[model samples]
Target: MLRLILIGLLLLVIFPVLASAAKVMSADNSHWSTARRDSTGIAPDPKTTPEAVVQVYAARAFNWRGIFGVHSWIAVKPEKAESFTRYEVEGWGVSSGRESVRIGSYRPPDAYWFGNYPELLVDIRGAEAAALIPQIAAAANSYPYRDRYTIWPGPNSNSFVAHVARNVPGLRLDLPPTAIGKDYRTDGIFGVAPSNTGLQLSLFGLAGVTLALEEGVEVNLLGLTVGIDILTPAIKLPGIGRIGFPQGPS
Candidate 1:
């Protein structure tokens, strides 16, 4: 039984990435720019849009890294607000003594990430968004590893969002299975799940098991997650995200 489980875990880590390698970009898009790419115009225009909006989005990571994981960020617009605030942790500046974590509002929250269309992970509008904004901001600002970053098993981009999710249960978010390194918890080896609704045991992010309402049952091995979304009726894989037709009926 133990060997079977090991084989299953190995397959989960390898098969999806290999199968999806054809779609993963081997190089960064020439159009890689932080500027807005709002061809769909789905992002709310603060001036015309309603009050209190919050959204979480994730896009494939740059270049060959896209084969393995995604980068995620949060955006919030408070009640009667005129604009949205976007927050994310960038790895480029960490080597130069600059903080990797940043917050701004110049670009649309839903903009394509370097030619990759982002997936909307969570959206809360109106009063609920307003109520959550302050807590989210606080959690982002107070993140302990603001200046640090690691591509795997670390305080990378996914870790930031996971931290905020753990702190704010109202979000009820489960980072996508393809979101590698989302289980890197610094507080301790054993603690509550980020969704605040379950228990998790981790070995410094290299391996872990999480049982939660939002996250279901997940096993993380070397930062690759394999899980089942019992509530949503889908099997979550490492690189391909959720399978079993998670997108709804055809």
Candidate 2:
């Protein structure tokens, strides 16, 4: 059986909500912008920070209920979209930090929308600047996914899917493949869009038992998503080795 490993890092920002609601102007542009004057009521300050960019999209990501709802803001100093995208977005951000994380799909086109939104309609969604201060301060400097590369970290089935995609062309595959490994204690937080209440899950060890968890977001299955964070002993399994590859290139 193939193991699957999919990862998403939801950098939860504790930002204050704007008094007004904003619509995403474009459904195609990945890099969005707001004019100096707009109804969203955001200030056009010369100081443009990552938290500022994050503030622009927080309302949208929380309002919509899928991966499409989540967006990225490439950082810039004394920010302007042109200089920002050229110097920072395409350059440093793509290769380092959370910006380095890939969705396995939606490759951004030249300074434009990569996943779903278009350029003309990519307006900024307003957020309270005060709420973002803490989250910005808490963000660490390490690469996002680097934290997950550890000992006995859950089923992480998507790893097998990638291996099969690369090594076994024309070979049919199946979902919910068999898995085996010792279980460990784990902690996680889950929530649906537009809801304040979050469900917390804690798992105790004894591997090979596949536990089913909801994707959390209540939108259509087209954007299905789920996560399992595990903490187990550094034991080796007979079938699944430590971070083993499924019949793929070494």
- Model 2, position 224, has a per-residue lDDT of 22
- The whole-model lDDT of each prediction reads 0.81, 0.22
Residues 35-99, model 2: lDDT tens digits = 11122323233344333222211112222221222222222212232222111111224324434
* The best candidate in terms of TM-score: 1
Q: What is the lDDT of candidate 2?
A: 0.22
Determine the C-alpha RMSD for candidate 2 after optimal superposition of all C-alphas. 19.0
**Backbone clashes, each candidate:** 0, 23
Compute the lDDT for candidate 1.
0.81
How well does candidate 2 match the true structure in TM-score terms? 0.25
Which ten residues in a row are the worst by lDDT in model 2? Answer: 11-20
List TM-score per model, in order.
0.90, 0.25
